[model samples]
Target: MSVPTPRSPAAAPAPTSAAHRTLWRWHFYAGLFVMPFLIVLAITGTIYCFQPQIEPLLYPGLLRVTPQGEPLSPQTLLERARAAAPAGAVATTYTMRNDPRASAEFIFRLPSGNSESLYLDPYSGAVLGSLSVEDRFMKQVRLLHRALLVGKPGELLMELAGCWTLVMIATGLAMWWPRLRESGVRAFAMRPASGRRGRWKEIHLMLGASLAIGALAFVLSGLPWTAFWGKQFKAITTAANLGRPGDAGAGHTHAPVREGNHAAHGDHRRHGGTMESLPLSEVPWATGLTAVPVGTSASAGHAPIGLDRVVAIAGSRGAGAGCQVALPGTPDAVYSVSCFPSDPKAERTLHIDPHSGNIVRDIRYDDYGPVAKAVSYGTSLHMGRYFGLANQIACAAISLGLMALAITGFVMWIKRKPANALGAPSRPSSPPPMRAWIAGLAVLGAIFPLMGVTMLLVWLIDRLVDRAAGVPSRPVRQ
Candidate 1:
């Protein structure tokens, strides 16, 4: 029996093509660089998806009230809120009809050279008390998520992470693409097999593929808001005739009118009374002016409508649920009544002159231009509000998927051995195929300006580390 024992089969040698090795290296290194950020994004994105539901619960008293009596006027609420605060503090009141509750908030400059927020209830006009940004859970989470508790550097890191995520998706797909004829496309998809490695691979592939499109959409839409991409996008948009035009009167070539000096003009207009003019800045907060106020157009003579009246008008105009009324700042200014109807697609913005209560302007989702509509839709998608429950579910699933991808990727990296050889030292492989190397470099350079720069830095660091570690380098031959 001892004599009959057969020799164990040797393990198959790993593939060693320069292209394959380079692809794996980039994928591995990029995964290492981006894992921490991906985790932060996943956690934050998951929490943010439920903000609409969570915010109401967290501030229930400020958001809702019993429908026992009529609500207070916006002006009265604002005054009450200010009385609750310091002497000079000004409060902004938000009167919400759908929830039957009102809220007032004031931003104050503290003695410590920082801004603080004080929340108040408009229904009872009681100060809920001041809240520090640090103490605010959502604010802290948002800051950490968007910027890693650091400022611009943190934001840049996040943008880089997002860009790397796209890279990971692309490289991952490329690596997973089966070259062999026998392998099914489903194999490249998700294949749940028995072992730990098999399970991890399945998760990595499945989650990566499922959320790739979503992640790409999120990244592309957000790129226009990034520093470099924003400038580039603005330039491109302007070149493509998509830029916002300057003010209508800009660059008008009208001849300049030589009006008399201030004193002369004042004397000339004194007799007309109707020709009197007031400073634009004083119009909103002005206290005294006996005669019919100067610059009183046809729309300015009627009585001003309060927030309550605005809400009533909006309801009468068939606004859907969750209507909000914003009071006019000046007599001639228009009250903005905005509503998000039961129909998730319906969003209406109405501007009504508070004086005459006449509708000055109306803009619905249907009225938006192509770019405006796209922007609105993109915002809705980003906030997970475009399709309500379905969107929420999709976002949640995407978050979970992202988390899974990160975990599995980390595990895969851990399973791989350090770059070394068995028994004897192995020679360095030749440079990668010229075409493949150029293509990868070009693609990466096009997508991330930082990549080429980072690669050069990495090369320098690698050289230093190799020298410091006393690892032998390939000899140069002349």
Candidate 2:
């Protein structure tokens, strides 16, 4: 996901032409729309990147425990959690950590359609209290970062803003490209003595040029999370066999039905057949679209395997500490075990049968297709999970740098704007050729259709407004 460093504007000769002004105008509008979102994303993203350190500090009582005797069995923890849970709440997942001080987490789906994470002391099996999944600080921040605290509509807005950010970066880089001078190491020099507008302009330029790659990384890596484009990307990758293997409906297995419970087994398969119906949370990206394989049929005269046995099964398959085991919701649902390791290469997901304690489906990093593998690593890098503390620091720096860039851009605009004028760059006397617009549209549409549609609509609106005001249209350059 790394890109080559762009040449600094200080290192190249400045291009000061009407074309540059045209590019500036585009950059200005894009920034005007994108800056606010960038600021919010930066602040929220920075907070979420340090969630590992921050969550423990914020919820020590809920997450920490005293390691007295040997830890209680996983089934014991689950039983205690279920007993403490609200009436009619169903256990969905259990998170076990190898850390002695860490409490085990049991996620439950309430009858009222809400989800809650119940913490339990591993050794004492004491109920440590439950937190509604929606109310968790880091969870809310993540939702905000992706969807602005709103739902689908907000997600689309964020996606559009993200797409426009690419445009903003492109136009900004274009405006920055010709400003290179042979200043060598001094090319990045800034002058605080310059007047207010000059200072802001220099700050904006330097930050924009320096952080363009990082900004691109953030936007591109995040595109897969967008509601529209992300779904399409997932579908395309999966269809091409370059993503998670097996179809969404391809992984289900019917359990062996008891003589009197054949109808119940049929009902379960009929109702809970799809992956979407599973109460899975925080699943790995590669397995997002894949179905959770159904467990074997509930057998008569025998009890289903215990949580400790499932844990042992996952451990035998290389899913060690920090693995989340999603308990079966229906009699036909398998025990879903997933480990999102800090190293992308170590990511693993296993679906173990609840009846026979057999490994139904085992997906590991090595099973991912090339594109899926790249995205796995890219996603890890984007969230600052890979490489541990260093990754988090780098991501935090990028997030903060983007915030600074947005602020500086806004400041420059404020300083340069006249009392009654919008300070946007003037249109070029010679309009760009039709082919240029067509080519730009084609390129953008191919890569990011949503952005291309928005850009085209904006262009049309600009033309309509200009024509309504009797603005003369210049001839397109040949």
Winning model by TM-score: 2
lDDT (10s digit) by residue, model 2, range 58-92: 99999988889899899988899888999999999
TM-score of 1: 0.68
Q: Output the lDDT of residue 291, model 1.
A: 17
Compared to the true structure, candidate 2 yields what TM-score?
A: 0.88
How far off is residue 313 in model 1, in Å? Answer: 8.9
Backbone clash pairs for candidate 1 read none
